[model samples]
Target chain A: MPTLPSLRASGGDGADPGRDEVASLTFESVTKRFDDVVAVDALDLEIHDGEFMVLLGPSGCGKTTALRMIAGLEEITEGRLYIGDRVVNDVDPARRDVSMVFQSYALYPHMTVRRNIESPLLVRKYRVDGDGAPPRKLTKAERAARVDEAARVLGLTELLDRKPAALSGGQRQRVALARAFVGRPQAYLMDEPLSNLDAKLRAATRLELVDLHRRVQTTVVYVTHDQVEAMTMADRIAIMSAGRLQQVGTPQEVYDRPANLFVAQFIGTPPMNTLTGTVTTDGGTGPAVDVGHGRVPLPPGLTTRLEEGRPVVVGVRPEHLALSDEGPLEQKVRAVEWLGHECLVFGAIGDSPLVVRQTGLARLEPGGTARLVVDPAHVHVFDPETTERLP
Target chain B: MTAEAVTSPAADRSPEVPRSRRRWLRRYSPREVLLALALLAPSIAVFVVFFYRPFLNLLNWGRFESRRNGAYFEDVGLAQYREALGSDDFREGLWHSVQFVLYTVPAGLVLGVLLAVAAHRRLRGIKVFQAIFSSTLASSTAVTSVIFFYLFNPVVGLIEANWLNDPDMAMVAVSISSIWQNMGLSFVIVLAGLQAVPDEVMEAALLDGYGAVRRLVRITLPLISPVLLFLLVVLVIFGLQAFAQIDIITKGGPVSATETLVFKINRLNRPDNIGIGAVYSIGLFLVTLVVTALQFAILERRVHYAR
Candidate 1:
């Protein structure tokens, strides 16, 4: 069971997650509406101490809005936010003690990297010295130490003197990271941090970010549209759609048992195939679904409740489809992508196309006929109207 | 490389270059340049005939000073230049102009930045405020001077300030009027610069825990440096050419306290010192040239354009 309680026993969950003293961040039914468009609608999320949580969604799905709300950059239309036990809804972003890494890596264009990273610390608070009418400015040595410490944290020591325009994209990202980490805030809010990098660079930065998270051990709320990024980096992913949370679970749980059709379709590559079918009783075993031209047996004990011909959607991942010389359902191969070690054959049966992943270097042509056998145990039935998974 | 190499050979393509270039130039024609040349040609021709030609003639004319009724006509080569350069009046006018610049430029820059920053936000009815702030652009220098003249009138003035009448404050009064007229231009320039900053940059700064003041000081100011430099250069030039404000309001009176270089040059229009006026005009031109060049040299290095 990948439940919160078990996670706590492993030192993965913080005690009293809603309490600001225990959790690094908490959103108590936060809602943000912009010009009648509800960007974030009654969202309740908590990031415990030392956890990496990714907010995953497609565009216009409110993930960015949720992250901004946590950063105190966006006004929370309703609900309260807490950082380490303090209600930060009315607090300005500067007082929130949370830092954000922007998608554009908006480095201050005028300042060198050192000055940029040092700006937050320098402006954090003002102090008056003994009998001094005015506040004392930071000493050169203090500023230098802070800059060096922050730069070392983000591996940006060599590039501190350079202007942002002079640095490459990856270096600019590091500078952005350095800027965020300089203050040593309680949490980090990263909005699509690696979306701008090339594929290889994205992979490399992903690993670096995980390692950095391990080293820093600070709570993080990462927002990304890429599910792979969400899955690879997040301890738990909160998937959103249409300004509503669709599902929240570990990578494998969401993959194996998605809450709805959107999550099922969104989390996988070459997505799960959904075929319209009718649920029929096959002698006391759970309601068997009669897919067109063949029947897929269901799990035990659902036969009596469901009617013989209730419309449903059968979802089976491509890898779960086994190929055979003489299977129940036949398909005509539409295309064949032959990797060196394995092959993926895409085919159409009746009116629906099926994707089958098979191991080995078997050559299948576009016109060839093949059999696709669905595993009864792996097959899932979803309610067509509600789009929720049914037993 | 493959895509380009597949195209027809350069010999065939090169022949069409001039034709397409000419067509492009024709379609997006430089109307401003043509209009500028058209309008300036007649003025430039008139200036050459009436101003430059007579000035050159006067430089020569000074060598042979003509006097009627028993006065001798003497030829003194470069003597008038030496005397004008050495004169206390020329030095006085130079100091007055420098003082005028000191009073006007800084005030204009500060007022412009303040108004621009205030009106740049998305406040309610802000557009109306911006329109009112820049409304001074509608008034000419002479009109502005006349408006301020009555406003600062000692007895019947709206402000009830005697500073305009006092020699100690005459330059400051005239600078106030000039600032009033020029503030609008400054506001417009700075506001445009402020508005041109991308919102993402500001949001990013906010997310990085920068307060409003830090963001403005560190990000907004630097991004708008080019505009500030432009406003500075224009205001300095306007400061140097402070004529109508002085002419209509002070008339170079109150013990010549408000007499700028242009006013001094205009004063040289008197029959006896025509040659000296040309010297002042030439001197003003040199000062403007040097000031503009120095401003550009010093400020250009500081402004960072998004490359």
Candidate 2:
């Protein structure tokens, strides 16, 4: 409920409540190229300690590629990777103090749940000294205690004896999470870990993961194509397209003030409507957006910066649109979708169809004409050709 | 109007055909069937001719008895079976066969797994190593036995080892030849299995903090059990049916120390005692069948298939 900048200024108390900085990872100009494809292009970001950061985009957006670079699973073409303080660009994946939960869950199909969890501890003991190969011996008691503790943390005590194949999808994901968290790595890299789960499970696990991040205080960089996952689970969301980062901000920050045209449509439910218009100055009064239907006057103080008669895009969220008896613009309703709490009416404005969200119920029918008005303060303007936000 | 519309021919025809039944043949087109049959036919024909036909002939030949030394003769119906089944010749031959399996199976499995694990990973010039690992497949068992026979020849061999004549080293020499001839196969099979494991699983293991050794013991081996089981079944069969190595290298000689069941059967190919030889052949067949079946029963539970 607090504003982003104010929240940043305040002592750290998030949904789960705490102020301590946990695990942090920094990537400095990380670039990874695979043969002809540039998987990651000049990516620069900081993941705050214990922050649940979601790298969200459509397929081939380089989200997975970025996560792999952080995990030391992929070679970084050009950049510095620091887990806490140490640069691990040359470190082997086995030595990197990071764990990854793959989209497929990647549960070792042959091993029992306990073995899978214990495997990390064994690896740690062998590599922790950083002298030689794995530890040649592990006392049974030490192995048992480690497995027991991890199983308890993941609520998998009863399923320790079961093979990965026998466990349910949710259980398998937990095992994967337990595997990742068993060694208590500095950060967790999850590559669409819940993408394989059913819709209901994904929702439940999303909440669980947020809570887990709070309790563990480990920085997590999660990759997902699902926007809802990004909105609900991430402390900060980084939206990417075509291997380039479009924007990074809190959920509300992204929704209220998207950096570009791409971010405007990428975030929020039902997407924002974009209308091509011309910015014109009338005498010396102010600049006005002329969107074919009618002219909507902009705030006078900000109008002088705008070029006269320049092409621009007026963006408005669906929820900000109001249906009125005597509104300025008229559209014929093409379809209506009734979501339990609200109704969304879709209508055509010239060649483009626009989405409008109305609270409660709507007594609207297909082919009916309605007057639509959007709040001026809630609208965003972008340079039409460049697609950059217009101040 | 609604009643008439409900009785339309299109509506009636829809329910007549079962959707699932229609899908049965449609799932695979004619081209798919042809492709599948084309791939499978050669192996099926070869198994019938080389394996089943010989097996049936051996079974039938085990009947009837005849003169072996020209002074002794009999018309024994399955009498040769009782004689071959109970004779010292059969017992000693069976013992040597078991000894051969003991010598070859474990050595083959361990070496195969070692080589496979070493070469499964991608490294500089790894493809060349992989090709070299499987190069043994080009040499026949006879060729390998001959090579070892000369390598370990007592008086004339280049090495001057006398391995074939020494009682302690005779079985060991035969085992070495068998291992050399068979290591390539086990390596190839296990390597294929290791390669088949999804990269995500290993990454998960590595991230889990499992070093290479723990990962190999806990994750890698178990995941590749199906392949290991396949190697076990194949290598054990090869060990049990070993003959060329004993024949060319030791000739089942030096007091029958290196004689395997197959080698003993080969010696039974005397013209007069065809029936007795048939009995030996049948005995070898039974032994191989029982051992293979027992192995499957025991090892099937240990194999963990991902799907």
Candidate 3:
């Protein structure tokens, strides 16, 4: 594929794509209800200008609904949405000046790629006073030029004459991207746009999207259930569960210091291993959590904040647990997965299942005993009753 | 050791025998063949009895002419076909049928699309509106024709119009009855097509800056073009073969102005004109064939079937 021309060179007036007019999005206590079910409940979030904000969660987490509400595809039942200081709750989707890429890549099947990219430009009702100006239509030549610029950026110039059905899945996705780009909207709302691509293609497209963002510098609100995409691309990740926002922070912040037990388990690939234990200061150590096997010491910083005798869940990431010669914890190995670079050892520690992400080859055999120790700083303790993380 | 050695030789020989026997047996299995024949019998019988036999008989009869009030027959061969097809009566009947098709086909298509698009939304009481639009399906053609006949009667009708007596308007009145009768079917078919379009496609269009009217014209219509074509073919066939509406409302009256091809064929069913009637039947069949072929050739090029 050929490299894209500089957006500045392509613009009629030598405008930089990075300096294009972008807007910040604000959701103020937005709620959407469907009869007896609340799809999104009192959500409050602010996306900065030119930021790539991703809503990450499992199915039915209201992530897609929130994105749709911003696009004005779904009505905001109880709160206000603003794009660039203008409250857009009552605005039509077209008038909101936001473009969207759907999960299905919803290309008009009957239209050629050129026509598909030109559709948004054709219907744009340009306003001067924001109220009563006559709509200014783009000329035929101008529309064609805009379509050509977008196609060149996405490497779709050769396929402009073909219909969507004639293109491959990945090509169709790029066409959808080109269509969204041609409109030059303030924000792009994408709903799991990469979910339909194959794994290898999805990874390649992920990098392309980050590069595109760097060049365009437009605000993007992307929704996906895949944490890998969220971790790699998002400037900030917002995690939602059961129609409520759980945590919103940088990827490292959310991973290293989860707001609750759900975020800890939901954000990682091998998922954090959790064991139920009771906080005990009676041990010789200052503060410790006693599982049935033994008592693990807690860091001094956390011990001062946690009360003794409180029932809590100890959360440890798989990579944090290491094999030691004589460690406090012992488990009988049940399974070993030997990936090329690393191995995953699954075993039971005192009736609680634990997974260890060991670097290099694993030597433990099934049914054999292995000693393990956890990094004290990486340990996370959650209040079992409320399921919230301890300071 | 002796038993194993003996069985090994026998097993090697047995494989060859069964392989060849199985191939031969599979080629003409009696039970499977009988089952396949049984499943296809009903459809084959219907095709032969209703379609093939009638068409062949009409072709054969077109070569003969009835004489002496049906007491005798003369085999005129291709001459009768040419003579009957060239007559002014046959041409007039065909012209009237074409006029009826013009009246009903476009009306049916436009009204079907309008009703389908209106009722496709998720508003409150939408089901009630759909039911009302589809209610005409319950009325038979003869029943609808009678109802319309009385409604447009010059003396006792609600509007008291002379539609059934005017030569210029008798076919128009009969066409009105046919269009009304076809609305329910057209609406249902078009609505099914509209429903098959995914909701995300419409949402994407809206985000791309399409208003309701533009979406219908550019997206909805093109997506449903195949369904509309199917409806067009059906309406053309119905309009050409329409009998009951003309029979009840005009009876080919007002100086034979509204006598379609089918009405002429029905009138020729008398004992003396059976041969000419058969010739007209063949001509109507050819006309329908040509029209349906032209429709597919022209419309299929524009249809975009979603992958």
Candidate 4:
């Protein structure tokens, strides 16, 4: 595990961790509560070894609570939580072998950058691998070498002597990250660590974070509310709302095949357009949805799940809706926004609003009628009662 | 825009009207300035009568020596100032005042922090404990002195020590009451400081593997150092101005061991010795000002103010 050869010159025999397996975190029906309110209700997520998992959600969602539970900063109010092979429901944060980066970049305001990074190694003793040996601390030289390496990796070497008050926001964030990764903990937990940064800096730091995760090869559980950040950096994104897990999949998988209506509306930029319809079999088609103005075809896989005159929700992405004159659906175009590269055509089919993403500016006028088409393969049907995708 | 518009022409036509008339007339209505001055007049008059006028009289009186029990006075000028300041009584009184400061200020800081840190927690009934810790602020100097005097008396005392009679320990006995009496204010202020520290910083320290003791020393203490410095300055002023505690408890007894500068000034403020008393009062004023200034200059850099 001592892959950093540059640090070996100053301190070779520090308490460096040996080849400990990258630990997988398992939340087995875990729940968290704050007085009468449930922050996380029966969350069962198994983050695999070395996976970059982003817990994506809005504010007041249980994403932060779940990350805190993994750090042992919060108590599990209901069930078992595992770090590696050990059930750490009652373990202290230090013994859990995890480090967290907070949204505030909670740097010690009085300490220099070097001291902040060196503090973890100074306070914690690492366990040697493969045997039942006791934990031992690193020597002073080893501590300095590790701090130097971590600072160099984070590009904070020049700022090692400065207090946090003197550093810029991006530099402070880098210092926070350096302090987190200096100790090769089992897993790194971050609670919206980049939300404090501006947009341009957040974009740049997102790549740096993914690069750091690649070099460390440790499991990183990053929590964020920005879907773009999740789509860019996550190996797997877990979407949550109101203390319940909605879906956990790769970025493209979630955008293409949302398990429910919430995930469908939340994952996209313009949000997926939804229309209410009733399933009817009297038209002699295998399964058809009477979408008020016209009937839209349903996929063959949903044939078993369809019932006559049953209300269902039809969904399609904005980019998938094509403007065809001979199409079945007619909408009254309300407004159009030309975004240089593409134009967003906003319209309404009766009372339900619809948006179409067209490449380049279209010759469309406001307060005019337009015919739109949805590909039969791209149609998504959801049960109006359960709000989950059907078939 | 209105302020600038009024000022630019006043600057361009400097010879016409006095700028004060034009400025006040243009920038503000006469009723506005009149109302502001009306609100400020009472404070200014009271300060002149009660504070500034008496201080000026004391400064002028420090130049002359009283004679024949205030029937006559001799303006010996700087000579009287030199003689009174260079006297052994003044030096001894200053030394005693410094000693009192050394004894009480450090105790006030440490014990205050101990009480504040102990009371500032998340457990049940903590507010009750906080109330008890700050209850000492309710005690008057005389009440505290009586309590300590009885607690240290030889015959009827609880602990029964001879410190009040001993030359060296009498000041320590006096300082104990002051430390106890001033604790409530210190605990309340320091607890406010501890509460103002953001919770995320402490939580981050815990997750960074700092144990309880280490976290307090390394994180909590440094974050509250500004409050500690403010408390230090207040305690120093209180220590220097200590008189009632000494009077009620030691009475400057046991060969005047507990006679701080204020106590000496109080004794000197008689009909015959009023000139020297003014000199000593001025001396105490200078000392207090210098010590408070020195504290801010030396400690402000080390104190961290969180943005």
Candidate 5:
């Protein structure tokens, strides 16, 4: 083992002698408190190896704090956290073998892109999983080759000599990614890395990040308030609000079956429109919710789980609401937004506003009424008392 | 101008904009430029009367060499400039000034940065320490020199050191006072610079696995190099012009070993050697100008200005 002034991960000669085995990150009953306020409360999650897990929430929902805890930037007030099999509750960030990309890109402005990418390898030891082949420092040539490969991977080869101040926002973002992956650390933690990019570039970079994750195949715990980024890039999305984890599942699963009202409203574009109602037995035809201007049927399977004439809040997504001439619900159209391929018809039932998505042009006008229907399969029922999902 | 003049242009675009209003948008109107000049008139007048006038007089007087202890004079043109500058007295005085700068500048900068970095954290009552560090700025240079003079006194003094009485150590003793006196300004400026560095950059470096020392050397120092360079230029200028400490502490004593260029110039206030004093004064100005210019030329390129 050479002295630790130089280290090379994934050097060309010894590249992938064995595949870089990644580590799963787990948090058990984790809690974080600041002064008097609880920032993250009893967070329990297991982000598996090679998984692209996104922590999705609104701002100040403890998403960034959770990611920082994984990076060892913040202390967990209670509970055990694990990277792989090690309980890294007291481990230093550097020895924990995880890397992070900050929202600001946090590139060393004075160093060239090459040096920025090569910095972690120079300082951190190679393969620090605390087992298998004692950790050793890398040689200089190996470090250089690893930097070259990272630069090539992130399309930063031509910009290696330039400082961060010289790069555009997107280019700086790539430099940040290159720096994070160049060391091949066990896991990568990102906190809203694309929030600074323009909308068009953000969309493009979302795909680029997903592709990078596929190639790198390392565990990623990404934190963001933007659902679009989470939906498009995450293998799983963990939704949080007000310092507590609401639910965690595959993106589609969370989108289709939110565990609570917060997850339902926070996971979709235009969000889920929830109207309060009372469940009725409907002459034993099974339960239905009388949602003010219309009575929408509940899933017949929910009859055994539901009570008669019980108070409930029914949720339906905008895309689930279809415009039908014979539909029972009468929605007074307030506005219509034509989005080329489809249109969003924003209308209301009495006082509750509802958004309905219709294919092609919505030949509807403001101040007119829209007849809309919601399928029972797409309707989500929640317990009005606790705001939790009703089975 | 009308209240909505700026905002109403788009609303009334079809109406032709007056030429003067257009010029104001481009940068400034002629009337505004005149007002700016008028505002600067007082400061310009003061500089001309008190600073530039005396400076020009000194330059002109450098052309003549005094004869017969100011009873007579001889116009030697550039000859006096050459001869007075080349004289051993002038050389020795300039050497002493340079020595004083070398003793004070680096030590002051280092001590300032150390103290600033120490007090820049978020510990409870840290503001008290910051106040203590910057308290030296409250004292006049004479007060600081007098305090040190008594502290280093051989009899009835703090440590009883004889450096002030020894010719070789006299400049070092005086520089000690100067460095202490200049430290407050440096600490305040450097602390401001350190505070301006975004906390996120340091956090990023931490996640990048840089230890504390490497983070300071590689990230912190380079990011604040511009501010450090500014501190250097200011300290260098103050060091070159140093006089009050010398006058109060050692009075250019110990066989005049501590007679810096400024001290010597003041000593030549008599009618006899004012010509030589003018020449040394001009020499000090040129040296300051060149040193500052050299520092900016060499170091400005390395400074990283955050975008």
Candidate 6:
């Protein structure tokens, strides 16, 4: 495989050097509806130029639908979408200048890798005069050069002659990437392109995708159900659930300050332990939430927001819980999972299920009782009815 | 280790000879073998009696020439085969068969693909259109031929065209019936192939800057090539064996322009020309075999079976 330098050189004068500058994408109150069902509801998002933004959600959460809208594959029912500064709501998908890698990779099974990569260029009608002029035909050499450059960038030079059926899943995925890259469109919309690969290959390809993003410097709107992919690869992560945007932030921001109960539970493994509790100032050791197990103290900032006897759902991540001999909460242990570096303790506080992440050689029998303490600052309080965080 | 050591010698010494015999007996047990033979007897008897016996009898009959309406017979051997193949009537019949195949096969394929592509979409009332496309499947070959025969009849046809009268156009008229009758089967098969294509692949093509026509040509067609090839084989066989259409429409008339091999063979199966009829039947079999082999050799190379 010829490296990135050769690819850049072969791009020729026809390649726009200013392509990186014009790749910002924005959705202004975009809503997509299918008959009576809403797939995406008033999604307003801004993906910066050259940013690798990931739409992270569970299946049927409308992340793929949102990405399809950007790719011009799905129509926006109610709002305007802009690629750079131009509204692209009415543009045909072929005219939108965006490429997508589907979850199945969707490599053309009949064509060799070279032909698959060159397909976009082969179909591209050349501009005779200017951007909107009458389209001319591309030369065979031009198509070949573009294909070669894309294949080289993705290290697919040797397998260019092989059909997609002959290639492994990861190689086929890279061919899909190369095909999308050959066009150098304004942005790339990826709908879980790595979901087909096995675990190890998915991880390796995920890293390669990040590297490819760095080299290409194009805005990418990637959708996936995996939070780990979002956490590791995204410059900004947009979390959605039930066709609504829950939060949009850096991975750490969404992890630390989830906007609602959904985000707090969805973003982490073993999820956050939630308990129904009443805020009572009568405990007199600062403000405390009287969960059924005992009263756990609330931080001052959260205390200011709570009224007396206000019912709130308190959320604490598994990592935030500590097993202390003299703690405020008692949990009956149900199971223990030792995961090399850390141990996950599954138990219950009264009737509410609780999971605790204890690091380094912590062992607790399944039938035993353990005292657990949650730091006040780490406790998240949400309104029970709306499931929205307080303050 | 101790159990294996104790059992190893006993296993090796006790069963080595009997094991071979037992294995043979197990593979070919009498009752099981009898059951298998009994199960296969019906199909084997049918093949030998209806298929192979007739073919062998045809070969034997091709060697003997009948005279005076089978009142006398003489063995002529391979000369009869040569004369049957070299006869101008047989050549004309074979040429007519080839012409019929050329007319119907390509028309069947193109129309099948067109109908399948048109109907394989997501639209309101598409099922109704699909049912309309496949409605001809209910009509048998004889019924379709009769319908087309009347439809193309010069005196009372809907269009009153001279299609069935002209020597050059009679075969075309007969082919039209076959193509119409085949439309339903071809449409259904091709539709199945089109449906088997993953929706994501089409969406990917759209995202990759392909328009509707390009997507169909580059993605959908190649993916369904196997189905098309299967349809091709079926259409080719149907074209070669065509009889009812020609029988009903032309009856080998209009200068014998539409007299296919099967029609000639049927005509020659009298008491006076049974030898020639058997020879023509064998020749037609070889021709069909060669045509099918050529089609498979050429078309199967281009087919891409989905993994």
* Candidate closest to the true structure, highest lDDT: 3
lDDT of each: 0.78, 0.78, 0.86, 0.85, 0.85, 0.85
lDDT of 1: 0.78
Clashing pairs in 1: A20-A84, A20-A85, A286-A302
Q: What share of the reference contacts is kept in model 6?
A: 0.46
Task: State the DockQ of every prediction.
Answer: 0.21, 0.24, 0.24, 0.23, 0.27, 0.25
Cα lDDT tens digits, model 6, B231-285, are 9988889888998889888898787989999999999989889999999999999
lDDT of 2 at B66: 65
After TM-score superposition, the amount by which residue A90's alpha carbon in candidate 5 deviates from its true location, in angstroms, is 2.0
Q: Lowest lDDT 10-mer window, candidate 3 chain B?
A: B6-15
What is the two-chain DockQ of model 1?
A: 0.21
Candidate 1 lDDT, A1-391, residue by residue in tens: 2111111111112433332224468889888999889998888887778789999999999999999888777889999888878898899887776788999887888889998888766766422232233434457676677578667655577778889877767778888887887665678899998988778768767877786776567788999999999999988899999888888888888888888889888988888887788888765345577777666666453333567788888888888888877576677899988887878888876788788888985567789888777787677778889998775
DockQ of 4: 0.23
Compare the candidates by DockQ and give the number of the best one.
5
Q: Compared with the true structure, what per-residue lDDT tens digits does model 6 show for residues A1-391? A: 2234422211236454444246689989999999999999999899998899999999999999999888887889999999989999998887877888888887888888898888777666544344545765568887787778777666678789999877767677778888888876768889998888888777767777787777667888999999999999999999999899999999999999899999999999999999999988784577889998887777657634677898989999999899999898999999999999999999999999999999986778999999998888898888899999887
Residue A211 CA displacement from its true place in model 3, Å: 0.7
Ranked by DockQ, the better of candidates 4 and 6 is: 6
Candidate 1 residue-wise lDDT, B1-307, digit = tens: 3212211122112121232455335544488779878989998999999988976775675554435521555566677677876789988998899999999999988898888998998877999999999999887887788888988897888776687778998888888988887789999999999888887679877765566687778788889999999989998998888888898988987988888888999987765666677667777878999999999999899997865
Q: After best superposition, candidate 6 residue B288: deviation in angstroms?
A: 0.6
Ten-residue segment with the worst summed lDDT in candidate 5 chain B? B3-12
Off by over 4 Å in 3: A1-12, A15-22, A126-135, B1-45, B154-156
The collision pairs in model 3 are none
Please provide TM-scores computed only on chain A for all of the candidate models, following their numbering: 0.87, 0.88, 0.94, 0.93, 0.93, 0.93
Tell me the docking grade of candidate 2.
acceptable
Q: What is the TM-score of each candidate against the true structure?
A: 0.81, 0.79, 0.90, 0.87, 0.90, 0.91
Candidate 4: Cα lDDT at A234? 94
Of candidates 4 and 3, the better by DockQ: 3
Instruction: For residues B1-307, write the lDDT of model 2, one tens digit per residue.
Output: 3222211212212122333665455578889889988999999899999998887776676776666563455656677789888998888888888887888888888888889999988687999999999888788988888888888876767666777777778988888888887889988888898898898888877665667787788878988999888888888888888877788888987888877778877887876677788898888878889999998899898888777
Task: List ranges where model 2 is wrong by over 4 Å.
Answer: A1-22, A125-150, A282-286, A296-304, A330-332, A360-369, B1-63, B68-73, B76-79, B85-88, B99-103, B122-181, B243-259
